[model samples]
Target: MADENGETRRQRNERFEFISPELQVPDGITHVWDWFWQLSGRRHSGPEALTFADVGEWSRLLGIEVLPEEVQMLMAMDDQYLRAVREDQRAARERAQQQ
Candidate 1:
């Protein structure tokens, strides 16, 4: 992640891609997903409670790694490493204001 490191990035990407079709989950987990999503998204302005270790441990105790994304997500949540994605959502809206 230090500068434009392509080789390092590729290997990191491969770890999460190794999950098989059986590991993929359906839409049922969306409710829980949304809850975690909202919590991580508000890290800066929110109450600043519950470390990522807490969330990851809870997910682990439940013994569910049904999706590749879920595996990557829970792993990252253990270390506050979520938001690896640079979502252009709000950024896209802000850029349009200048145009």
Candidate 2:
């Protein structure tokens, strides 16, 4: 199925891999991910620095009301993503050192 933006579900999932596939509300999650990605320059630091007020501002800017649970989900996803990236970076550094 395609979203309103004509993006197929698979494409959307690929684009926003940080979002959980089990989410019943993928569209809202995608929006939140997109906004967070933009806010953070696609870096882990962006989500790490977010405050509750920033989330409220995000709601106002996106015109989408997100529940607190949704926010928690997003935060958890961000943490997981950050950890994965860090692990990948560490492996790359180790490989470079070995070479």
State the C-alpha lDDT per candidate. 0.49, 0.62
Cα lDDT tens digits for candidate 2, 1-99: 233467654575578685645636477467666665554553434225455676677678878778878778667766776675566557657968999
Quality of model 2 by C-alpha lDDT: 0.62
Estimate, for each residue in 1-99, the C-alpha lDDT of model 1 and write its tens digit. 221334333354466585333334448766455646554654563234446564565557766444557555544553453243233234435767979
Residue 17's lDDT within candidate 2 is 82
Worst 10 residues of 2 by lDDT: 39-48
How far out, in Å, is residue 67 in model 1? 16
The lowest-lDDT stretch of 10 consecutive residues in candidate 1 is: 1-10
Task: Give the Å error, residue 60, model 2.
Answer: 1.4
